[model samples]
Every structure is written in C-alpha cells, then in structure tokens.
Target: MHPLISAADLRAWLARRPETVLLDCSFDLADPSAGERAYAEAHLPGARYAHLDRDLSAPKTGRNGRHPLRDRPAYAAWMGRMGVAPGVPVIAYDRQGGMFAVRAWWVLRWMGHADVALLDGGLPAWQAEGNAVTADVPAERPAPAYPDLPPAMPRIDAAQLQPRLGEVQMLDARAPERYRGEVEPLDPVAGHIPGALNRFFKDNLQPDGRFKPAEQLKREFEALIDTERPVVHMCGSGVTACHNLLAMEVAGLGRSRLYPGSWSEWCSDPSRPVAKGAAA
Candidate 1:
C-alpha cells in the first residue's frame, strides 16, 4: 500500500470501515496549543488529535531540538491509547501542508507499524472536497502494550551524522530562504549544516496541495542525488523533514535516515560548522 491516501479513498474507507484510526496531527510551531484548539473546533469525523509538543515529542533538554522524538515505549503506549495497534491501518493528517502529519506517519513507521499512511494533501484536501467535519472526539480504546518492536526506519544522531557528512547525501528540507541563511525565524541560528543540499519539502506537493506523481518526484530527486545513495533528511526542528522522507518513500527512492535534532540541535553546539548560501 502507498504511504499516502487520497481524501476520496479515505471517505470510502470511513463509510464502510468506521474502525479506521484517523489521527489529526495538526500543529503550529508559533502557537503549540492552536492545533488542539483547532481540532476542538472542527476536524475529520472520528479523527483523534495528536499534539506535536505533548504527544509526538519528548521533553526538551537543552540539547535536542524543539521537537525531539518521544520515547519508544511511551510513544507506542500513546499510539495504543489513540487506538493505533499492531496491524491497524492508521492514517495521519494535518492542516499545515502535512508537515506534522508526516511526523506522525514517520513515528508510526519507526515504531514498526507497516500499516500506517498519511492523508494525501492533509485536512485542506478533505475540506476542499466538501467533506463533513465534526467537533466530536472519538472515544479512546483500551491501550495496548507496545513490546520491543524493532524500528523499521533509519535515524542518525548528530554525533553519527557529523563525520558522515561527506559520505552520505544530507538533504535539508527547509525553505530556500532558510537554507540560504536569508531568514532565521524559528531557530536561533540561520544557515544550514555544511554539505547539506537544499530540497524544500513543499516541492513535493502540487498546486492543489496533493503530492506530485511518483514519477515526477523520482525525477526531481534523481536530479539531486542517486536514488540508491544513502540519504539523510533534516529541517529546522526535524518536523518538515519527514515530508521529504515520506516523499522519497512514495517515490520508491528507498529508505533514508532522519537527523531528528536538525538545525536547532546542530546550531546549539558552537563546534559544528554552519554553511551559508546554497549548496556548491
């Protein structure tokens, strides 16, 4: 099954199988509580809310980025509470161009759940289709224990990534301006990690907000680096970078590692080198 599902397909699935676990992973870095507030206002029918700071990320320690990956067992337990169990078909969506949704998708995938997917184009696409949105929250199911499930995805830490910079293709998923050191809105430092190529996550989507065709994504990524080459994805706080990773998966470009700490963590240490402007 593809990593993305269209709104029409999701609607059809919900009609027949109401047991499908739909998650509203909408979040805003500017105002963290806005996502839950928006969810309380209106969200997809039967969709449970997942907050980035509360549910998806672990506590900040001055070392990790703004949104660090949640502990494995705790996250699995949270997923269980959200009605996502082993073999359950989980679909995550968000309003902000699927940025937070892809993070949910990646988390589930990393937790050894192969039946997870992202709602293509996210909440906007569903709303655009004139689908009904409800304020009612779904009832929680009995939480299941997530045993030692080996991760299916690859991830690299800053320590492991720094030395491998020249060995692997590091893709920075931030905007062109952010990658070029033109703006520093969120993170303390502007510029990106040295040797990292800029590939804005938004490029994966079409004007209509849905992801482009697999062939198109394949062509675009191929122009940057070989499909078979080892690739590591990063962004401001390791959020939007998941969009790039999902795009690569949809493009059948094979799996890639994620630098979860991202730019924020990289810049936290003064010893790490920061590159300005575009990739050479």
Candidate 2:
C-alpha cells in the first residue's frame, strides 16, 4: 500500500481485515491534553488513541529537546500492547491535517514496522466520506512477540550535524516567522540552523487538507533543496519534521534522515550557531 490512504480505501481495508490497527493521533502542542479529550468525544470506530506526549515521545531532560524518542525496546513494547504485530496493517490519522499522524507513521517505521500508513486526509476526510465515528474505544489485544531488530529510520543529531552545516541540506519545517526569528512561540531561540531552508510542513498539503499529488510534491521539494546533498529534516522539537519525510516518500524521493533533536536541541546548546532573518 502507498504511504497515504484515501478514506474510501481505508474503509475497504477495514472491511477485509477488521483486526487492522487504526490509531488516532490527534494532538494540541499547547494544551497537550486536548487531543485525548477530543478523542473521547468521537473517533473512527476501532481507533486507538495515541497520545503525543505520553505514547509517542520520551520524557524530556531539558537537554534532549522537548520530545525526544522513547527507547526502542520501550517503544516496541507499546506497539506490542497496542496489537501492532508484524503484518498488522496500522493506519494513523489526526485531526490536524495529519500533522500528528505522520509522526506515528515515522515512529512506527523507525521501529521496523513496514505496514504502517496514514489516513491521507485524516479525521475530517473520514467524516466527509459519510463514515460514522464512534465514541466507544476498542480494547487493545496483546500481539505476538517478535525479535528486536535495528531501527529502520535514519537520524542525525546536533553532534553529527553541526560540522556538516552547509554541506547537508537541512530543511526546517517550522513556519516562515518561526524560521526567520521574527516570532518564536516555542523554542527559546528565535532562528534556524545556518544554511537551513524553511518549508513549512503545512505547505505539503493541498487546500482541501489532503496531501498534494506526488508529482507536485516532487517538484516543490526539488525546487526547494539541492538534491545532490544529504537531506535532514527538523522542526521546533523534531515532531513536525516527519511530515516532510512522509511527503518525500509520497513523492517517491526515497527516505531521508531526520534530526530528531531538531531546533529545540540545537538552541539548547549555547555553543551551536543560530541563524536569524530569512534564508540568504
């Protein structure tokens, strides 16, 4: 299956395999609890709520950025508990135009699961297709255990990315203002990594909340960053960066590495250089 699944296709999949794991990854960075509360009100039938701060992220230690990854074994255990064993189709969706769903997709892939995909347009599209949502949550069945394998997703950290600054194509997924040091509501530092280009994660979506065509995404990405150099994606605390990576896969650009620590980690270190203003 493709990285993105249409609402119609998702319904079809559910009909054939009722045991498929459908995850609702709705989140609000500010309130944090808002997502789960909303999930309780209504969600796709059989959808399990994946909390952003609780399920998908590691506890922050001030230095590792706001939302570092949970250890591999710990993450695998969570997946096992959620019934996401090998070959189980996992469909992640979010209310925010897949803003949080992509994170689920990325993390699941990082955990060595290849059957994960996002509900292309997320909750809005699911409802728009006349699919009924339910307030009742499904009980998570324990999945069979599997051997721990090396992580599949590639990553870069501050220590590894600093020296290669201009040599690597760093793409900052934050909004233009956040990237430009004009306004920074999150991270303490109000700038981006030097030589990093700004391409707001939202730009990857069409006006209707669905992702743009794969060809359109390919053109936009090719025009933004040099294809010759290595590409590493980042956002305020590394959460939104996965959206771009997912977009690239949809564009068939192959996988790229993610700077999981991202800007939050970069700015935490007083020694790292911070670039302000727009892209030069």
Candidate 3:
C-alpha cells in the first residue's frame, strides 16, 4: 500500500492520472548541488526536484550536527513549494534505489504525512523499464492541506545518548571500515562510539535496491538485539542514518530514534571519546 509506486507501478499510475507527482531525489553527498544539476538536465515528465542539502536540511550550525533536520515550519513551506498537498500521494526516488529517498520518506512521516512512499529501485529501475524522460517541469498546483509534525521525532541528543550507552541498542549505520576505524575519510577522527554495533545502511536493501520484506528485516534486526531495548541509529553526517530507521520500520521493528549529530558531531567535541577497532 505504501511506497505506492514501483518503477513499473509508477508507469501504470502515470497512465491513469495526470495529477501524480514524481520527485527526483537524486543526490550526491560529496557534491551537494549535484542533485539539482541532474534534475535540471533531465527528469521524468512533470517531475519536481528535492535537493538534499538546500531543501531537505537545515543550515549547519557546526555544533548542531551535520545535516540538521530542518524546523517543521520551514520544511512545511518547502513541501508546499514542491506542490505536495495532503491528499496527493508522493513517490520519491533517487540514484541508488531508495538510498537517498528514504530520508524524504522518513521526514514526511516525521511531518505526520503517511501518504509518502519511496520509488523502489529508483530512477535506474524506471529507465530500465523504458520509461520516458523529459526536461519539462510541470505546472505548479495549489498547495494541499499540510499535516502537523509528529508528537516527537525519533531523536536523541548526545547528552541523552551518553547515559544510555550499552543499555540500549545503538546501531552505527556507517561503513564497516569507518565503524572499525580502519579508515577515516570524512571525519578528523575515525572509529565509532563504544558499545555500538555496525549495520551499514546498505544491508537493509536487496541487490536490486528494493528493501527486503518486513518479515526478513525483522528477523535480521531481531538477531541483533532483544527488540525490547530502544534502538538508536547513526551515520557519518546523520543523513544516511535515516535509512536504517526506515529499514527498521519496514522490518516492523517500529520506532527507533536517531542520533542527529551522529559521528561528525560526536567527534567534534574533544570530551567524547572515540573507540578504535571493533567493539568487544
């Protein structure tokens, strides 16, 4: 019912309704503006663009954590600008299947809109299916009713996290090497928080780039923890970390909080110790 449009399903939907909106959420983490450039070059007919850095994230306050979640009011305005109304089901896609678009999915849920879904396998799959593309942008529609923000976002600050430590299941959604401190490319420091387990976000998806089924995901995640303890996900900048959160939900693990500051912010403060190598 959700993630309503697969690459094939989207084509069917397009045939049936002219009002459907497709969002090109293609993003490159290294070059923040690359997503916008790709959108400008070519996209699905009547599709709009959502940029990860400019449109989806808040201004970096250095200490506020990289890719800080935008304020609710600010985000709601952007949703309107993107022409998403309360009733219209939004289908989001990215280059790596749902890798980047999952953030949009999670954010929309956080905003209390349950009508959003990721485009399974993203643009690659769509083009593979012989879907047509165009540079033409669609006419803007009137903004639909906006939803209220959820009662509380699944998040925890460093202070709230420090105390929990081993008590809760903290999953690091970073690459294995980064989690093990074998290599450090982005951060000044390498490694992860002590007691955290590595579960690279990519693991949640199949080779085809679609998410694994809920039952399979639940079994995998349950093997990691009791499923009774709270789950906290973190990544390099706090962006991809949401992928894990989305996966957890898909797996029927329910609500898991995010460490918004994640590794970047964690290492910024000298007082916070970083663990090298795998956790014992």
Candidate 4:
C-alpha cells in the first residue's frame, strides 16, 4: 500500500471501517504546547492526539538532539496504550505540511508495522474539504504487549555517517537558509554537513499543501542522484528528514536510510566538519 492516503479516501474508509486508527500528529517546534491546544479546539473526528515532544520523542540530554527518537520498548508500549496493534491500519496527519506526521509514519514502520500511512495534505486538506472536526477524545483501549520486533526501517548513527559521506547521497531537508549557514533558529549549528545536498522538505508539496505528483517528485530527486543510488536523509533533529524519506518512497526512488542524530548532534561535536553556502 502507498505511504499516503487522500482525505477523500480517508473519509470513505471512516464510513466503512470505524476501527481504523487516526492520529493527529500536529506540532510546532517553536511552541511545544500549541499542537495540543489546537487539537483540543478542533481535529478530525475520532482522531487521537500525538504530541511530538511528549509521545514521539525521548527525554533529551545536552549531547542529544532537541527531539530524539524514543526508546524502542517504551515507544512500543506507548503504541500499545494508543491501541495500535500490529496488522491494524493506522493513519497519521499534521497541520504543518506533514513535517511532523511523517515522523509518526516512520516510527510505525520502524516498529515493524506495515499498514501505516500519512494523511495526504494533513489536517488542512481535511478541513478544506469540509470534513467534520470534533474535539471529543477517543477512549483508551487495554494496553497490549507490543512484541519485540526487529526494526524495519534503516537508520545510521553520527559515527557511521561521517565516514560514508563521500560514497552515499547525503540529502538535507532543511530550508536553504539553514543549509547555507545564513540563519539557524533551532539548532546550535548554522550550516549543514559537507557534501550534503539541500532539498527543503516543503518543496515536496504543491501550492495546495499536498505532495507533488509522484512523477514530479521522481524527476526532482533523479536530478540530484540516480533513482537506485543509496541515499541518507538528515534534517534539524531527524524529524523533517523523514519527510524526504517518505517523499522518496512515494516517488519510488528506492529505499533510503536516515541519519537520526542529524545536524544537532553533528554540530554538538565541533570536530565534525560543517559546510556553508550551496552544494559544491
């Protein structure tokens, strides 16, 4: 199945399959609580809220990125509490052009779940289509044991990434300014990894806030690297990097790995080389 589902398709699915799990993955990096407040005011009917800082990320140390991946067992337990059992179809959405939603999708895939997808265009598209929004929180289900399954997604650590930069197609999903070291409002670092190419995650979307056509995405990425070449994605804190990974999947550009520590961790270690300006 595709990694993305249209709002219309979701509406149809809701009518036939009420048991389908819908997650509101909206989040703002600037204001941590904004997502929950917005979710409380209005969200897709039957959508359960998932906060980036709370549900998706782990407690951070000075060395770790601002938002680190949660521990596997703990994340699995959280999924169990969210009533997400293996084999059930899950859909995740966010208001911010899927920047946050894809993180949810990536985690589910990592946890060995195969039937998860992101809501194409997220909450904005759903609302634009006149879909109903409700504030009623869904009831929790009895926690089930989330089996210890091997990770299905591919990821690289900072140590592994440094040596392989020259061989792999390193893609940075941050804005051009951040990539060029002109401005960095979030992470301590102002530039990107040397030899990495910039492809802002938002560029994957159309003006309507939906992802571009698969053919278009394929064309855009092919210009950067061959369709079959091994690519590793990175962004501010490993979050938006998943957007590029998802876009590659949608474009059928072949499987790519993620550098989970991303620029935050890289910049934390001053010894790692940082490149400013456009791709050389």
Candidate 5:
C-alpha cells in the first residue's frame, strides 16, 4: 500500500468504515505546548491527538536525542491506548506539511502495522478540501489486539554508523544552512555528521508543500546516489528525517535505515566528528 492518503480518500474511507483511526500530530519544536493547544481548539472529527514529546516519544535523558523512538513493548501499549487494531486503517496528519505525520507513519510501520499511512499535504489539505473541523474528541476505545512484533523498519545508531561512515550513503536531512554549519539554533554543535551528504528534507515537497511526484523524486534521488551504497537518513533529532524516508518509500525505493540518534546525539559527545561547508 502507498504510504500516503489523500483527503478525499480519507473521507471516503471514514464514510465506509467509521472505525478508521485518525491521528493529529501537529507539533512545534520551539513551543512544546502549541500542538496540544491547537488540537484542543480545533481538529478533524474523531481524530486523536498525538503529542510529539509525550505520546510519540520516550522520556528524554540528556543523552537521548530530542524525540527518541519509544521502545517496542511500551510503544505497543501506547498504540493499544490509541485504538490501533489489526485491520483498522490508521491515518496521521500534521499542520506543518507532513513533518510530524511522517514520523507517526514511520513509527507505526516500525511497530509492524501494515495499514498505516500519512495524510498527504496534511491538515491544510483536508481543510482546503472542504472537510469539517471539530473540537469533539472521540471516545477512547481499547484495542488490546494491537500488534507487538519486531520492527519492520530499519534503524542504526551513532555507534554502528560511525565505523561505516565512509562506506554508507549518510543523507543529512537538515536544512542547507544547518548542514553548512551556518546556524546552531537547536543543538549545541552546528555542523553535521562527517562524510554525510546534504539532502534537505524540504526538497521532497513541491512549491505548494505537497510532495513532488514519485517519478521526480525517483529521478532526483537516483542522481544523488550514483553508487549502490546503503542509504541511511538523519536530521536534527531524527524527527524530520522520517519525512525523507517516507519520500523514498513513496518513490518506490524500499524503506532505508535511519540513524535515530541523528545530529543532536552525535554532537552531544565531543568524540564524534562534525563536518561543515556543504555535502562531503
């Protein structure tokens, strides 16, 4: 199945099956409380809120990156609480393009859910399509049947990535400025991981913020990596990197591995090398 869903398809799906689950994952890293407030004020009917820091991530110790991936069993319980079941379709959306939504999608895939997908173009697209927004929160339904199988997705850490830096294709999903070490807004360190090529996550989106066509993405990404080096993605704290991963899947490229410890964790320790001034 495609990793993305259109607003019209979502409406049709919900009409046919009211058991379809919708997740609102709008979040602002600058203000942690903003997403919750936004969901409270207004959101899609029957959509449950997934907080970036709270529901989506595990507790951060300073060592773990900003939004660490929740461990499997705990994550399974969380999904059970969210009403995910064996055959139910899960749709995730965010106000900021597909940034946070893709994270939910990727994590759901990792948790072995096959029917999960992102709301392409996100909440804005839904509103533009004339879908009604409501403040009504759906009553909680306990789905004890949510699967807890081993990860279907791939992942790597700084320890495993450091040794193979030169051998693998490490795509840094940060912005150009951040990749070039020009800014240091979030992390203490400015530069990206050494031997990493810059592939800004936003490049996957069209001018209107929707994802570019699959053919275009395939062509661009094919040109970016000339060799058969294994692909690994990373961003500020492994959040936006999921956007790139989702794009690759959309482009018919199979799911690639992710460095969950991304730049934030790599820079936390002074031992890891940081590179500056464009793709290396």
Candidate 6:
C-alpha cells in the first residue's frame, strides 16, 4: 500500500529513515514567483523546491492549456536532475491542502513510481503543529541515467473527446460556477466539456482542509466510473485537476490519464465546441 503520512507519521519517519525525500511544490497561478520566494524565505528542512511552471510543465503552446505536460523523456531527465532515482519514497507538500503537491504525486505515478505520498494539510498544517523550518538550499545531485518512458500516454484531444462523450467517463474538477458557465475566473470561456461530470477538487477535502480517507473517496468516485472504464481527469488549467487524480488513487480507483490543457486549452479556440450546465 502507498503510505499516506500524517504530520506525526512523517515526524516518526524523519527520525528513523534517511531515504525520505521531501519535495516542496508550493505554487501560485496568479503570482508565479511567489512560491519560490516563499520557499527561499522559509521551507521545511531538507526540502527542495519543484517549480510548477518550469520543472513540471512544458512551454505554452498558444492553443494548448496554460500548463501542458512536458514530454515523458524530458520529464524523466528532469527527475534525474532533481535526484529522484527509481524506487525512492517521495513526499510532496504545498501550502494548501495538497493542491499543487498532488500534481507532483500524479506525474510520478504516471511514470510508474508507486512509493510516493502527499504531506497531509501541507505547510500550513506542518507549521500549525510547530514543525521545523529552514532556509537552507538542498545539495545538488550527480547526474544519473533514467529509463526510457513509455511512448503512448493515454490522452484525448477535444475533437476526439467529443466522440467518446458518454461512452467513457470524463470528469471536470473545476468549481460548480465555472462548470455551469455562471462565472469564469480564469478562462476565456466559462463552461465545462459536454458530458463531463462535476466533482470540484475541493470536495475531496475534509473540514480541516485535508483530503478525506480512501473509503469516502472510493464512494464518491465510484458514483461516476466503475473500475472497468478508464477515467479522463480535467480542470480549468489542468493544475488542480491533479487533486482529483491523487484522490482517486488514494481511493483505490486506480490510475487515470490527465487532459493537461483542460478547460483553458479546450476553450482557447473559437472553433472547439463548448458545453454549459451539468452533464445530461
């Protein structure tokens, strides 16, 4: 089982295990530089910053979403630079409830690395409990070789997605207002993909802003897709959508492919079709 570590559990692991790799993935879509500045000011001891814009995503393709997935080989090479070798246990965290950190988690899973987990409640929770913090930069790693990634990553274009509509399960992790086109906070178009199910990523959180347990998460996801059909996960910019992907994994619903462009890229062109309101 993939270990889900609470703050206390992490503290325990820190004391006994030297193999723990803590990654700081704090990010801000509005102010991109804020995350790095914050990490430099004060971060968990031995934590390394993983920039969402640079380290995790690819260059913007005007038509593609704001943050598209980098090529698997490129990403694998980047991971090697970050000192992540095969079979290492990784712990990712962010200021919010594992929001951005989950992206790191999802990408690692896509690469078939299973010994990874998100820090519950993220930095705020860690600080609330008086965990240690430092401004020291982590040591760089010697370049190591990485295995070749799979060529075919399961993903769908908007045109291709239209035909698969109800046949395969599609999930939208955006807010209800955005899903309904009531008000769009980030995109040019303010609606969701037709036939996409709405399950705001925040819904996966508990009252404490931490993710709910696997049992509850399983119930929520099973309502949409059985384990049989492959699930396609999407969101406004394909960032927070990772929250759903991570939750589903914790829920034991298995892995799902991400629509990296999500609503942002989906609505970039006037020619692409747009759907409003809940899925019919």
The most accurate candidate by lDDT is 2
lDDT by residue (1-280, candidate 5, tens digit) is: 5888889998998899899889999999999999889999889999999998998888878788888888888778888999997778899999988988888888888888888988888888899999999998889997884666777889999889899878888888889899999997999899988888888899999876789999999898998974355799999999899998889889988779988879988888898888999873
lDDT of 1 at 24: 96
User: Tens digit of lDDT per residue, candidate 3, span 7-28?
Assistant: 8988887787666667788998
What's each prediction's TM-score?
Answer: 0.97, 0.98, 0.91, 0.98, 0.97, 0.91
Where's the lowest-lDDT run of ten residues in candidate 3? 144-153
- Where model 5 places Cα greater than 4 Å from the true spot, the runs are none
- Per-residue CA lDDT of model 1 for 1-280, tens digit only, reads 4799999999997787777789899888888899999999999988999999999999998789888998898897888788877767888999877988999989988898888889998888999888999999877775576656889888999999888778888999999999999999988889999999999999999998899999999999999987788999999989899999999999999999999999989999989999999899
**On residues 59-129, what C-alpha lDDT tens digit does candidate 4 reach at each position?**
88867788788889988888887888877788999999899999999998899888899999999899888
TM-score of 2: 0.98
Model 6 residue 2 lDDT score: 60
- Go through the candidates in order and give each one's C-alpha lDDT: 0.90, 0.90, 0.80, 0.89, 0.87, 0.81
lDDT of 6 by residue, 1-280 (tens): 2635788788877787656678899988889999999999988888889999998889987787888888788778877777777766788999878878987887776776666788888887788788889999989873464566443225666677767776877789888888989998777788887778898999999978778989999998887667678988899878788888878878887777788789989888887678897777
The TM-score measured for candidate 6 stands at 0.91
The pairs that clash in candidate 1 are none
lDDT agreement of model 1 with the native: 0.90
Residue pairs with colliding backbones in model 4 are none
Q: Residue 216's C-alpha lDDT in candidate 1? A: 98
Better of 2 and 3 by TM-score: 2
Residue 118 CA error for candidate 4 (Å)? 0.6
lDDT of 6 at 41: 91
Worst 10 residues of 4 by lDDT: 138-147
